[model samples]
Target: MSSEKSKYIVSAEWVERQLGAPGFRVVDASWYLPAQNRNGAAEYSAGHVPGAVFFDQDVVTDRTSPLPHTVPSPEFFAAEVGKLGISESDTIVVYDGPGIFSAPRAWWLFRLMGAKNVYVMDGGLDGWKREGRPLQTDLPEPAPADFHANFNPYAVTSFEEMRGIVTTGSRQIADARSAGRFTAKEAEPRAGLRSGHMPGARNLPVGLLSTDGRFKDLASLKQAIEDAGIDLSRPVVTSCGSGVTAAIITLALHSLGHEDNTLYDGSWAEWGGRTDTPVVTGEA
Candidate 1:
C-alpha cells in the first residue's frame, strides 16, 4: 500500500491510545441498509468506542433535497459538525460497525469541508470489539466548537454536470452498486426507480474494494478498479445506490493518489428515479 494511503486510515490500536488525547476526536459513522437490520443510533447507545460520538448519517443531511443523505450545504455541515465538537483542525477518526463501510463518507465529508486531519479507523468497530478494545455505553457531551467551512465545490458532481459527462464522456463514471443492480438482473432496494445503470457507467461494486469489512491491500484495490474497467490515470466520478458506499471508491482512489475524482452526490437515487436520465441494462 502507498504510504500516502496511510494518511487516510488508522488502526484500532492507534485509536484506543488516542481516546483522551488533546484535539483528537472519534466518530461512529455507522448506517446500515434496512435489509441489514442494524440501527446505528441504538447500537451506539448500547456500546461504542470510549469518547466517540455518533454521526447520524440520516439526520445530518440536506433536508431540502428529496434524495437520501444529500451532502448538506457547507454552512450546514459546519454547524452540524461544530455541534459534535469537531473543529476543522482537530484530528478526527471515523469508523462504522463494518470495517470499511459508512465511515469513509464521514471521512470524505470532513475533508471536503476542509478538515485536514481526518482518517478512517481500519477494521471498524467490529474489529475493535473482536479485539476486546474499550467500549462505553454513556454518551459523551462534547463541548461545541466552531468548525469553519472551506467546502471544495470541485469535489462534488451535480446532476447537471453528471448529465453532461454521460453525454460527452468527459469523465469515467464508476458505479459502486452491485453487479446485479448495475446490470438490472436484480431489483433495486428503492422503489419507483429504474433497475439498470446510467449509460457509460462501469460497475465497481463497493464490496470489491474491501474484504470482510476491511479494505483490500493497495495492489488488490488497483486490480479491482482495473477489473471493473476503471482507469486510474483518468478522472473518475464514483456513484452508488444513494451516494454512501461510493465514498469507498473515492477513499480507495484517493488512497492510490488518484486525486482527479469526484463523488456524484445524487447517485442512482436521483438518476434511476428520474425519467429524463437515460438508463441501460447489462454491463458496461
Candidate 2:
C-alpha cells in the first residue's frame, strides 16, 4: 500500500486494496463542529467504506469529565474499542469525512492505546467517494475481539502539567485554533471561555498544516511550523479548542521525525474555560 507524507498516512487507493484483509480494521473517525451542520454518524449511516466501523468520538470518551471528548481510561478504552472487533495487533486504518482533520486524533489515540501500525487514510472518505471507490450502506456485524490496552500515560499532557509548561516554558505550545480565535478577534464557539491562547504558545492554526483535507509534504510541514515561530528541535505540546485538532499538529511533528512531543489533553477547553490559567490575545 502506498503512503503519502509518512507511513502512518496511507492513500485511499491503499486503503481500498486492504479492505477486509485479515487482521486489518477500518474505522470512520468523522466528527464535526455544531456550526459545520454535518453529522458524522448520520453520514456513515448513508454510506461509508465497506467493512468500516464508526468510532464515535462522543461515546468513546471519559464521561466522568465535564470537558468535551476527554480521553478515556485504559480499561474503558479497551472495553469500548474491543467491542468494535479491534485488537491491539490489528492493522487499523482511520479516516474522517474531511480526511486529515479528525482522523489524526483517532490515529494518535490508537497509538496512545498501544496499537502499532495504525494509519490515517489520506483524503479521508471524501476523497474515497470522489474517486468513486466502493462504499456500503450496510453495517457489518463484527465479532468482538480482545483489545488489550497498553496505554502510554505520558503521551498526553494533563492540566497541571500544562500549567507548569506555560509557567516554566518547559515546552513550546502550538495552538491549532483559527487565527481569529487565537488573536481574540473572534469569540470562542463555546460560551463561558476566555478568548486567545496560552501566554507562550505559537499560533500554528491547523489550517497551515494541510490543504483540502490532505497533509502537506515534510518540507512544507516544517516550513509552516517554523514560520509560526516553533523550533522543531525543542519539545512541543499541541493544543486546540478542545483536544481534537491538536492531533493534526502532533501528526505533522511525528511525520518530520520529531518524537519529543505530546498532546495536551485538556487543551483550550480547560485553559480558556478557567480563570486561574493565564491567557493572552493578539498573536502568539
TM-score on alpha carbons, each prediction: 0.97, 0.98
Q: Estimate, for each residue in 91-209, the C-alpha lDDT of model 1 and write its tens digit.
A: 99999999888999999999999999999998988899999998999999999999999999999999999999999999999999999999999999999999999999999988888
- Candidate 1 least-lDDT 10 residues: 1-10
| Candidate 1: C-alpha lDDT | 0.92
Q: After superposition, how far is residue 181 of candidate 1 from its true place, in Å?
A: 0.3
- Model 2 CA deviation exceeding 4 Å by range: 1-4
lDDT of 2 by residue, 36-149 (tens): 889999999999999999999999999999999989998998899899999999999999998878889999999999999899888988889999999899997899999999
- In model 2, how large is the Cα lDDT of residue 227? 96
The TM-score obtained by model 2 is 0.98
